[model samples]
Target chain A: MDFFHVLVVLLESTIRVSVPLIFAALAGLFTERAGIFDIGLEGKMLGAAFAAGAVAAVTQSVWMGLLAAILISIALSLVHGYASITQRGNQIVSGVAINFIVAGSTVILGEAWFRQGGRTPALGEGARFQTITFPYADSIREIPILGPIYSDLLSGHFILTYVAFAMVPISWWILYRTRFGLRLRAVGENPGAVDTAGISVIWMRYRAVICCGILCGFAGAYLSLAMTAGFVKGMTAGKGYIALAALIFAKWRPFNIMLACLLFGFLDALAIRLQGNPLPLIGQVPVQLMQALPYILTVILLAGFIGKAIPPKAGGVPYVKER
Target chain B: MSTPYAKLPGWAEYGLIPLVNLAVAFLVAGLVVLLVGENPLEAAYHLINGAFGRGEYLGFTLYYATTFIFTGLAVAVAFHAGLFNIGGEGQAYVGGIGVALACLWLDQTMPWFVVFPLAILGSAFFGAAWAFLPGWLQAKRGSHIVITTIMFNFIASSLMVYLLTRVLKPLGSMSPQTRTFAEGGQLPKLDWLLAIFGLDIGTAPFNVSFLLALVAAFCVWLLIWRTKLGYEMRTMGHSPSAARYAGMSESRITVITMMISGALAGMMALNPIMGEQGRMQLDFVQGAGFVGIAVALMGRSHPAGIIPAAVLFGMLYQGGAEISFEMPSISRDMIVIIQGLVILFAGALENMFRPAIARLFAMQSRRSAVVAQTKGA
Candidate 1:
């Protein structure tokens, strides 16, 4: 293949792989903006993936699987909300607990329900998200650069991929332009001020957490029904953490989040492509190094080697009403 | 309306509350067992029996507990300094490299006794070094330790995989592990210690590491409760602003505390590498570092409580393995579920029952005060 074709393929795969990261990073943006540190994003995504895969396999309805994924993820989010918000507990500990619970429960429940060794049956075509080919893709292929870019790179993506891309602008509008978004951001930065304005800080945080749940649910469904045929054991495979790194790397901005996710996704695609492939001077690049790049970059960014990425002022502290 | 805050007595605060939380965790776990279509009571019986039924079972339980103690103390020490050290898993993993290097170098030349101390030092140094960057980042660079530590975990996993597969793997070896260590590298089994109780620890990997764990626990207690640095750590943990106001260096304490925690976590590798596996291998830590979080929270970050909590988890692990053997439907993941529940109840939902219990205590104290007034009248 020519260099251009390889580049197109690489970018296409980057978009495909980044779909989950986009969903998850947006999910994190909502919660972190509302001052709730949701380390449980991994667990929520995993739970949703299992639920979607199992329900889709059993009912053979993609809609039902999506519904199940959303519900289960929301339920887990509420558990986090209860511990961190209502009980005024340590948010990190609550998130960690949720992660562990979901990680263990998904396997146990999957095994018990499916009898397939912690995996659901392979999903049918109807039960999985079908890719949508953009109009005029076949006829436009005769053109040189733009034709392949339109047909191969942009077209023939699963619906969730489009939805993930669409969410960026919607999230940007919701976080920056809307009234609720303003309140949510205000609550995260200063719950005391939001509370003084008679807007309920607790309710604002709950809403943000639920929004996080919805986005994570979509991320999970994308993993099981859109990315692959079915859910394997531990299929999320630290993508949630990568999403978190991307979120931090982006400094929790919607457009920046998308850019970060795409960057990380490109690294992932490159990692897979570069396995055992020799470069000009470097000889063989270790796939592990490629895999570790996003995290390494995130750490470097977090260490302020690049520009500073400050979290919300009240990011981890639980608000207590002082009489 | 919220109930008025009441100061709890030491016994209720430390002992009764934790027990209640533990009971709730176990009850939830039982519900999970029932959901899996098994007899919860029967599972409980089997679990207890598997942990303590025979000398061999007890030996295995203690063997697991030894690893937990090291990790638990690691978390607890960090907790004392108000830092959450979730990188125990990575630290422990890197610590294996230290133990392996020591053994690979001295195993064939030196006696076991001479090599043991060097291995301990090597593991501690590597573990501490692994943690140092995150600590420095948190202290000097103003980064969150939690995120950095978590990032370090993935980096450690990748580094270990590279080392084991490409660098450390012996020539012509199919497996991604080093060759078994020589006799000097192996820890002597503590069979005689168990035999003194008129019981044989048959084929258990229980070894001198158990005693090392105990000694470490004692040392941790001395460090935390009996030293000037311990007071500084406690002050910082209680209130960082107060610690700073008192002229304690925040950066120094944070870095030193993390190194101490990392050293303890690193020592955990000895239990498996020297005591049991006798060689470095992949994933030998096996979530033990995470288990330390549960142990520290359950034990209230005290060495006195950590030992018992670690042993309880050891029971759950040993028992869970037994249950999986006896029952086909239930897997070892059941223990993980229980562990999650324990962390949830004991760590996060710890205050769930505190208010009601405090109210009960308040009422009792009020009643006694009224009776005393009537008697004085």
Candidate 2:
């Protein structure tokens, strides 16, 4: 109704929309840090979303749904690691193949199991996530900036939304502070050195991939069970790629991933807000341009129009132990 | 990556392995269909009947094959140059813009013959223009070609959506498509060519574009295997340092190679715009460009391999539709699974069985050597 209320709504929408992206970006950070390029992030997320949504709809338990999603996504990760790490296959080709397989299989399996044309039955309230409320939030809403922040911005998001935001710091710690993080970074940079130091390069990469799978699983589960009610076809639609773009935009740093995903989320929220909203100078904006903005921005960033964005040096190259 | 020259005969290397992969994919597809409570054998029959055994359907199958051939060769050309151009989907989508503009401009004044060639060039030019930046970025900016190409695809799709809805839609028409092309914009069907040979068949969308696909294949073969530039591309793809030592400009070659690949992908619009739709429309390219990846990989990035592979996919597409038609339980997504399985086996798992085959070859040679030694003794 008022300008401040609108801003609060927009911020709320931004956080809500960015939950999956934050999870996915963190997921990509793990694999890419270990020198594995995971274009199949999209595929894994899609599979998990479908699995989570279907299981939750049937069993009416969000926890079991989340578990199923994690298992399925982990299975896909194993497939990718086996192909790229064990078989020494082309990583890009393997990723593309995984996308193809997951994209197709999710639909087929959904159709066979549910007979609902690639969608699960929408879940009940018990099967979907509930919002968390901060203490004494409603009583203080009459005040100005802090009131709206308390009432609209910080309060009443699905439980996973907080987890998604919290993951940024946790990821930062895991990637930059822990010994495993140090070893993972070194393994990606020089697997030979890690190998010489008595660490197994194959095992290290597998571990990174497993972490990636878990994060992506959370992202997918959130999309189906928390953000929305059921798994529609391709519900994770390009967010996986968007998270990937965010990954590169942040140069694979965890904190940077948060900033990038939030930025994308804000842009998405703005697009939704600006659907037919008019401005003083610009007049009513076209929906297409707003919809196209994120991609255009990514291209600009990637083309070195903004700044240099380099991936891990050894990313996409399969590590072969020449014995 | 190139495999060491196989000890197995050429047929076994090319034919046996791919066929085995196809068989495995089909077996998985059959199982999926059975899981949905359908008969796989009957489903296969229906697919065959829909693609070929049914009336005039072979023409449609070849029609779909024509588009695959173009996009497949686009991928193959880039592959041979050590570039992964996944943006073929985007390139082809943008190619529709070129064809649309050409038809809109020339239909009012020019003859069909003159307009057709001009439109063909227009499509290639536009598609190449779309791809030029990614190629340039890959060459000069040290960006990964696959990432840049993929990023370009999203941009292309969005750009096309904007162009269609905001710019190209006819006045008072809510639909995001241009008006039907005039006579000068249409390309004659292959039925006319077949009529010249006195072969009567029912009407289908099969067009002269199939012939163009064949000609393009021949030209691609010449360019890759016979030309100086072709030699440079292969050398570069195999080993970039070796190419640099041989005095080739790496950046120029990368740019040129991607442009050529983009042009080939762009040409696929001829069938949909000039042959099937006879007008500009949103989503003219569909998923054909993505499918081209599977085609190129399964074909081993060879023109010789790509043509047959394209035809086989064309069958799967047309037949998959038939399966979805007669049996409601086996939905359209089943076809996508089959396509994915084929990609999994043929591309990702390509080397999975090669070692075993090579072992067999080695064992046979060793047994013969043992027998010869005994005979000499």
Candidate 3:
């Protein structure tokens, strides 16, 4: 491909790969904003993906499957919230347990129910998301650079790509402008202060966790229904953790999170494209090197190799009533 | 006036929580079995029997326990240093690689006496070196150890996958594993010792690794309990500022602690490669490092305490395998549920039961004070 064609493909690939991460990153933002640390995003997303894929396969309806995934992910989030918040348990341990539970249980159930080792039967096109086209942009293919870029690169993404982009703005507005957002930030910073002002800390945290669950549900749907047409064992492959790192790298800002997600998505897309492609200049980098790009980025970002990023003051510390 | 009977002494205060934690853990595990449509009683019976019912199985349990003890100590050491070394899995892989390379490349030329110790040392060195980068980042750059170590794990696993698949495969085998080590590289099993107790059984895989594990545990206990360095680690884990004020080198301690933990984790591969496989395999150290976290938590991060905890976990692993065979319908995931519950209960009850005990003590003291005051008045 020529330079312009390569550029268009890169841009298109970036948007496609970034959609699920954007949803998951926004999910992390919602939980962490409300003063909760959610390392369980990966588990919730995987659980929902499995649930959505299996349900959609059986029901032959994508919407119903997506709804089911949302409900199941929310239930798992409740388990996480209750264990960490209600029982005064360690958030990390609770999150890790949720991951193991969902991972092991989903595979076990899949094998028992469908006689598949850890996968659901792939769904037909109608049962999965269809590519959404902007017809006007398609007609503009005759125009110069902007038209070609917009029409050729961006016009035929899955429906969820638009939604993932839209979520960034909605997340920004909700976190920065609303009364609930203020309370969420306040609670995260200091639950005692929020409680003294007559707000219930428990209820607020539950709301944050639920909001997180809903967003993660969408992320799961995007993965199972939009990105790929089915579920496989450990298909998430640590994307949730990558999203979590993106949350920190972005300093928990929605806009920054969007940018961070795009950067990671670009690297991921580049890696995928680079695989099995003979690049004349660089010779051949092992596929494993490309797979490890995001993690390497996370360690670099975490090491303050970029700049300082601070977490919420009360993150991971569950509120306990004092006598 | 006498101290109130309601209050537990210090030992009971520390000891009772773990027992209660164990009870709650087993109860939760039993409930999970029920959820999976198995008879909880029968499953539990099989679990216990599978672990300790036969002499051969018991040897397997001990062998499994050896790995846990090493990894658990590795985790506990870092825990004492107030560092979380999630890279144990990766470090262990590096250690395995080191042993494999030494055996494959060097064993032909070296004497058995030199090759064996060199293999152990090589494993430890690789593990320590693998951990050192993250430790350096954590100390020098203020990177969070949890994230850094986790990243290292992915890198390590990816590297191993590449090596096993493309680089390290034995000629003509195309399989994702290594060549069998030369005889000089193998560790000798203690069949005669077990035979003296009339319990020698199994396929001669049981070896001196168990003794090495216990000795490592004892050494760690000594390092933590008797030495100034151990005291500093414990203090630093509790509070960095306080440790620094007390003259501990934060950076030095971080690096040293992670290296030691990594070395200990690497030692685990010695058992499997030198004891069982006589070579490295793809399925080597599958999640044992992660399981070590649960073991360390359940053991309350104590060396002495970790022994029983490792044994408990080893039993669960062995029995989990056996139970899966007997009841093919129930997925082996029932073991993970049990493990998750054990970690949950142990973590939760540590904070939960402490205050409850304190309250009981306070109430007893108040009652005694009231009696003493009335008698005096």
Candidate 4:
């Protein structure tokens, strides 16, 4: 392959891999921006992936699968909400518990219902999301540079990929321009201030959590329905955690989140490409190092080497009206 | 507009509440079993029988408990210092490197007794070294320990995979594991200890590590309750502001606490590498580090409580394997569900039933006061 073709292919794969991270990072943005920390994003995504895969396989309807994914993810989100928001519990512990619950339950349910050793059946073409080609893609391919960039790199992606990219601007607008977004940010920074302004901190946080659930559902559905044809056991495989790292790396901003996800996604694509290929000085790059780079970068960022990452002041602490 | 509920008695606070939480967790687990088309009572019967019916089964259960005890104590020690050390998995993973290095180096030249202590030191040193970065980051740089430790877990996993496949694996061996240990590296099984109770271990991997685990628990108890550092750790955990006012160095305590916790977590590798597997292998920690969180939560972060909690999890693990064997429909994941439920009820939603229980106690106290007043009149 020529250099241009390889670059296009790498960028295309980068977009494909980044869709889930985009959706999940945005999901975490909504939740953490409202002062509720959610480490359960991984569990929610895994649960939704299982639900989508199972429903799509059984009914052969991608729409039904999408709905089931949303419902299940929202249910898990609400459980996290109840524990952290209502019960005044430790948010981290609640998140950990939720992660464990969904991790175990999805496998148990999958095994009990499908009996495929904790996997749903492979989805048919009709049951999985189809790639959409933009208009005039075939005719435009004769042109150089811009043609392949538009047709191959930009166009011909699964619908969820477009949705994921679109969510960045929407998230930014919602979190910055809208009143709900302002209240959400306010609640996270200072719940007492939000309460004094005659807003219900509990309700605002719950709404943000619901938004998180909806976005995570898309991420999960994208995993099973768009990226792959079926749900394998542990298919999400630390993507949610990576998304969380991306969120922190982005300093919890929507545009930065998109950039962070794409950067990580690019690293992932490079890792896959460089599996056996040797570079000039480094010799063959170990795939494990590539896989571990996102985490290492995140840890370094968390250590404030690059820049400081300050979470919401009220984050992880349950609000009490009387106290 | 509202009256405060009465304080629970000591038994209810520590004992009764946890028992109720455990009962609720099991009830939910039973419901899950029923959903899977199995009789819950029969499954429970089989689970109990599987854990204790045979001497070998009991031996296996205790063997599993040995690993949990070390990890649990690791988490509990960190908990006492107000740090959540979830990187136990990673710590233990790297700890295997220390163990493998010690065994590989000294097994041929030194006696088993001499090699054992060196291996312990090696494992603790490596594990503590693994944790020191996250700890220092948390203490000095103001980073969240939870996030850093979690990141460390991924880093450790990647590092171990690379090491095992490229560096540690024997030249002729295709598998991603070290060469099997020599006789000096292997821990002797505790068949004689079982013989005192007129039982045969019968192929169980139960070994001297179990005794070491018990000794570690006792040491943890003494350290937490009797030592000056222990008092400082508890003060830090309960109220950091107060600890600061009392002239305690926050950064020093945080780093020391994490290193100690890491060392305990690192020692958990001894059970599997020295006792059971007899070599360093990929993923030998086997989610034991995460299980430490559940154990520590259930145990209320006390050494006394941690022992029983670890054994309970050990029962669940051994019995769950038996259940999966007996009833094909019910897989080992059921134990995971129970564990999640236990952590949920005991750790996060611990106050779910507290209000009702407190009200009940308040009513009883009021009734007693009224009766005493009436009799006096």
10 residues in a row with least lDDT, candidate 3 chain A: A108-117
Candidate 4 lDDT by residue in tens digits, A160-268: 9989989999999999999999999999999999999999999999999999999999999999999999888889999999999999999999999999999999999
Runs of candidate 2 with Cα error greater than 4 angstroms are B1-8, B192-203, B374-377
lDDT of candidate 3 over A174-241, digit per residue (tens)? 88899999999898899999999999999999999999999899999888998889888788888898
Write the candidate numbers in order of decreasing TM-score.
Answer: 1, 4, 2, 3
Worst 10 residues of 1 chain A by lDDT: A98-107
TM-score of model 1, chain A? 0.98
lDDT of 3 at A195: 94
Reference-based TM-score of each model: 0.98, 0.97, 0.90, 0.98
DockQ ranking, high to low: 4, 1, 2, 3
Clash pairs of candidate 2?
none
lDDT of 3 at B105: 71
Candidate 4 vs. true structure, TM-score: 0.98
List the candidate 3 regions with Cα displacement exceeding 4 Å: A1-3, A57-60, A124-127, A136-152, A190-198, A320-323, B1-12, B110-113, B170-173, B348-377
Q: What is the DockQ of candidate 2?
A: 0.63
User: Candidate 2 on B1-377: residue-level lDDT in tens?
Assistant: 44453668788788888888788888988987787788999999989998887446777788889999999999999999999998999999998888888899988778778888888899999888878888998888887788878888888888888888888888899998888988888888777665675554477788878998999999999999999999999999999999999999999999999999999999999899988888878888878998898899889899999999999889888888888889887767776777777877887777777888778888898999999999999
Residue A57 C-alpha lDDT in model 2:
90
| Candidate 3 per-residue C-alpha lDDT over B1-377 given as tens digits, one digit per residue, 9 for 90 to 100 | 12222457767655887787778778876766666567988988888898888777777777788888989999899989878776778888878987887778776677556666777788899899888889988899877787678788888888888888889897789778988777777777767767787885577366787888999999999999899889989889888999999888999999999999999999888888877887888759887887787888888888888988999888988887888888775567777767667766776334555567667778888899999999999
Give the lDDT of residue A68 in candidate 2.
90
Predicted model with the maximum lDDT: 1
Question: How do the residues B110-146 of candidate 1 rate in per-residue lDDT, one tens digit apiece?
Answer: 9889889999999999999999999999999999998
The alpha-carbon lDDT assigned to residue B271 of candidate 4 equals 93
For candidate 1, the per-residue lDDT at A312 reads 94
